[model samples]
Target: MAHEVPGTELNINTTSNDQSAEVGNAGGVASAGTVQAPVGTASVSRKRQGSPLEAENPWVIDIIREATSKQIHEELKASFLRGEPDMSAATVFFAEVNQKIQKANDEHGAERDRGTIPGDAYEKLYADFKTALEKAKLERNEEAALYVVQETHSKFAKFNQEHHLPEEWNINPDAFKHDSMPEVAPKPEPQDNDSLFSGSLPDYTGSETDIPDNVSTLEELEREARYNQSLSAGEVLYWWKRGVGTQTFVQYGQGSSKTYRIRAGSYEVYDPESVPRILSSGALSGDPSSVSCQGKQKLQYRNEKGRIEEAWAYTRDQVRGIVGVGWKVDDDDEEGIEPLDLLVPEPYATYPHTRILVLWVDGAVTLEDRAFIRRITKGSYLNVARIIYHKALRQEIRYRKAERLPYEHLLDRMPTRAKEKQDIELGDEEYEQDGEELNSVEEVQPEYRGSVQASTIRSASTRPPSNHGRSRTSEVRFVEPALEPRRPTSERGTARPSPNRVPHKSVDIEDPRDAKIRWLEEQLEMSLNRNHQSSYDSSSRWRRYNRYDGRQSEVSEYTPEPRRRRRAVHRERVWDNWTGSWVTARRVY
Candidate 1:
């Protein structure tokens, strides 16, 4: 027997013993089906001569097939003649389908537990099984019809043999039915459960008149774009295409939801970071004006003239004025674009005295404007532009209000020195030696502002005496000294008056020990006064009582001179010849 070509009416025949073969043509139909007896199980050669695609294929599998009408008729006739077939002889098509589905499901479950499947292949496999099961039923029923026809024929053949019935009786099984009997139509087999993915095709029906194309006349595209060009700012426009998800986004509360038609396969994809809530024009796709960015975003657009036009920042509710009160993100916009939470402009104290400068600025106050400031600072042209644009805005916003240093720019401009105490009373000679006193007021020098210093300029007369004051101390200052001509070193030696010696010639000189005692006394007096002030200022009584101060209070402007204590103890010295000690020379109270 020869094997037949699967779909076409072509047959190839060859005997295992006979190498040569004859090509038979029964109306160009293959003779394989008519050949009887196996030709020793000869293998069919799949070699094709012409096409590369067909040449290498070793197996040909047919996906879908149905019984032809003639085949169906023959099957019915055969089934009638055979009548009821032995249940064992009737073949069960796809008998292992359920087991295969269960096994696949078990494997799929295990894979799901192991997390190896890319998608839910189990569902697809199950669906496929259901589909295969239905196809198998069709094949089985078509094959079973032959047996039904065999049974019918046998029933009529018995009558033909017994009573010489006519041929019409075989063809028409219900020919002898009573007049009152109801004629019945074959019960229809259930069609395979409509495929799980039986979705209607997307309707892309529209006419050129619907959206009279723009640039139907323009030769090339240009940047001259307007916001309200396509659909008016608030108008609704629906759209769809193959790859891109269906329809322009719509805020459902608006009438656009009901007004527009929804075609099949519409979807919105969401992604954070990369995807903004309302994408501005020229962001991810198309021209800026093609889609409204929810109208809440502040976008810079160009008019027909090409000048950049800015829209003031808008509130979400305010955006409703453009897209209608229903202005909101799509239901699928969860991942797409989130709502905005503008950062409050809080000046971070990154720079020294930044808060003070910000306070000095008329209105600048928050960290919120940092991004805006940075953007402005990033000039399209040059870094110098960053300085100008942002600097101008900063000045407008009063970001850095540090005025021209408030004084002259000095050489060492960055130093910040502590303020020196003022108002100490000083005698004239000391002043004359240190530097010349200003005879009149002087203007602040530019160099002073630059760096030299901010010297405390309090008036001497206005300074108050300290609590321990013996003679009032002179107030100290750090002002720039007036320029004076320097004396020659040769002359400086003789011309420079010695601080301790008198200007005139003198023979007697003060003992060095006496100078030390004088200095020690001054230090002791200052220390005593400091202790007294501290004891008074301290809140703890124990600290005050423990001060151990034994000195006189100075006549300060704040306090009158205290009365001197009685001389209860006097210093007396007696020479101890054996110990060699002088008691009178000791420091005594």
Candidate 2:
């Protein structure tokens, strides 16, 4: 048992009578009859080094106990070999062993009672260990702890190896095992941001977030730098400079209908474990037409079988960098990934998660674009309008306290109370069936209602006689009135052409000879009438008629006789035949 010094609770366990004798000589303990030592005076006042008092420091006892046990284990073996007579050694060994066993018991007891190690006791143990190592003049406490740590590690390793573990353990399994493991391919690593902003680009790794560092195309870099000045945090913008555009990611599916806030850093993309950084400055307008990177030019190293292995540590930006000179003028054109386009950057070599925020200004601030702007900015219409004004008008937009702008006022701006329309959610099955019913009702409304109205009107106009006693004939006569006949041309007093009368000779003359003879007689009569008319003078009522005779006229047969007599009677006179007058003619006799 450890001897308690006067006015002290120090447990100094000594083996054999010699050690106890030495301790008693150095510091005497008060006997039962002796004047009781002052309880807290000397012991508390005493300057203790190496081991402090029990209450002030219980750890001393604990360390002593453990050291005692180790000593005992060693002594037991030594004593067995020596075969006794060395009482001092035996006593010292047992004393140390007993102290260590008590300490172990105390520890187990504490755990049983409290369900965990006491905070104070742990502090004591750690302190004692620290003191022991210091006293021993060890180079480092870690060197001592390594023994326990290595033993524990070996035990676990042996167990795992015996049980046939799949592979070696690692804090970063992918970083170590990716290249060697043929079964699982490594995902493309994110490139350094520095490389992407620059114009030197490498291959793309099929990830939108794999934009490079400073290496961007001259055009892309310039465009992005300009756009960068105009963005807000969490505002999703297409970073086309690095070939990471809104259209590039759109193929996966319909993106957030509202603009989703962009997470900062390339690692955040497709890496859920990556802690995304939010852009505090809210860079709004840094959209580039295309991208480039330095991931292609950078190199890195890894530890192999006691040697460093040289390999590429690509960043998201570098992995996406491709060999292209110009921007993709067409927004919809998305190129496929190629091997020659792979890039690796330096900074991404060791950092865990490095991501960049991409804010997309899809269209100029329009009403439709405002919806997405609202989601991304987490702002209201008025707020977005203010942003637009700052961007477009280059001046701060202000509003009256009680008034609103046209666009702002027209938004879904009704008061909460006014917007209390009932909205009940229905299952898909119910919704589809209800929609069908509604469509059917709409389809039948016009056709059936018009037909029904027409039928009702007809029934009202031609109602079946209420009094069935009415005669059917009277009903029919009243319903059907008499009609008037239409007048013919003769009855209307209009003149009609008279029928031609045919002579007996000309009538029904089908033969050509008969028709000709009848036609000549008619012409002869017409000519005779015309000659008689021409001979009459307007002053006289009498007209000279041509007297028809059976014989031919002599004057007609000898026409030369009349001509000779006429020439003798009026040799110098010329007849005006056209006007039927006489006139003198130039004599050419």
Candidate 3:
């Protein structure tokens, strides 16, 4: 059958093997329906000329544009109206019409998967066509829908292989499993209740249970136990489970009741070499099920690696300033009363030296409150009194008025200069002499002044009569009596006349009149006689003596000594001159 194209009014060939093979025109109207028999199964061609991306085929576009609206309407009904619709009959109808259209249009995404329709088409077919198949199955065409499902899978397979798509694109083989599928083994049955609970807890082979022997000694552990008044969390748990003694008690107080599972055992407490294991215990987490003694609740404990460990536990309210004060309990005041009893007290019963008790007494009291409690409360019944006393005890006390001055104050009061000079033995004698010199110089200056004037008068008297004659030496003291000479200047000042200037005998003396003069006189006399004898002997003896003489005499006729060749101004300059850079210098005697 053929139909007219819209807008162009062209007629195109449309009849194919099945009546379903009728095309809709450019008017976009659907084809008439008709029933047809299924075609023989066909394998998809491995060779794809390229994907059906064809606006390339002129024939396909012409066919779509020429077929009329009425023709498409008749074809669609004819394809499904037959006994039962199958893959070949349905595919052939759409193939001759829509396939050619898809091949011609790039926008249809025909190239997206080889041999398969685009995603929109696949979705549209699944919804629309699947619905129709379901309708057919309801109308006694169940075989038709099953056949369509198989064909859909086959089409999808062809699409994956032709496109070289990823393995994930392939349909899962498990989905298609039939009678040939393998069976899986069944899971083991759970054990009975008695068997499960009857089993003993496994021994902790994963880690060692016993603390190392090297951790601490028994004595150290005891000391720590007494000091801290408790055991460690691990030790507490350990003892509770396996220690020598275990006790149980139900405590009632503070508007609540708790059960204590107490354990007693000797635990090593001090490990000087190990890092302190401060624990928060169950008390910190507010578990209310367990209590730990000798533990730092909410405190940081460093291991050897300096990491804060989470494995150990302790209480949160055991801090010193916060003890008995910070913990939250039922029926407690918003501002809690200072607890009379320590909910968690120090392990050691004895109080610390620095502790002091502060008591608060309420006005209201009953006989029972006074009597039965009096027996227990007369002393420090509540640990709080003892703890407060122990925590606040004073070490020393002194009355304000009786107290001695502080060391710094005593130092400040001392005479600084006097104390510094006390060790100086040289100072006492010096001050005495300094005083005497000052007094003598002050009081005796006039007498010394009078003596100086008298000496001037004597010196004036002894001066020469004004005749230009050489003055005779007069003894006059120019300096003090301490500096005056013992002898007169006329006899002692002049050097004694020596016969020779150079004396044979050496005499050292400050005054020229001493032994130097006598030695020089003896040398001069011997020299004079010897000179006379030598002069008389003369010529022959002189020649012979000259031959024997090694010492050369200096030339006596005042022969000018050959001028020493002056070091060429500067020896350093000679080298400089050789290098063409001589420096000038002044002549020196």
lDDT of 2 by residue, 65-177 (tens): 32443344344445433422233553454354345435433543432222112223223333443354344334433445434334433543453233221112101222212
Q: How much RMSD separates candidate 3 from the native structure?
A: 37.9
Steric collisions counted per model: 44, 59, 45
With candidate 2 superimposed using the best TM-score fit, by how many Å does residue 86's alpha carbon deviate from the native? 23
Residue lDDT tens for model 3, 184-251: 34568997656555558543444455655555778787776656643222122111223343321111
Where model 2 places Cα greater than 4 Å from the true spot, the runs are 1-50, 54-589
RMSD of each: 32.9, 50.5, 37.9
lDDT (CA) per prediction: 0.30, 0.30, 0.32
Q: Candidate 1 — which residues are off by over 4 angstroms?
A: 1-82, 87-233, 236-243, 246-589
Candidate 2: 10-residue stretch with minimal lDDT = 393-402
Give the winner by TM-score: 1 or 2: 2
Of the candidates numbered 1 and 3, which has the greater TM-score value? 3
TM-score of every candidate: 0.15, 0.16, 0.16
lDDT of 2 at 567: 40
From the highest TM-score down, the ranking of the candidates is: 3, 2, 1
**Tens-place lDDT digits, model 1, residues 196-222:** 666664444687556444424332332
- What shift in Å separates residue 97 of candidate 1 from its native position after superposition? 31
TM-score, structure 1 vs. true: 0.15
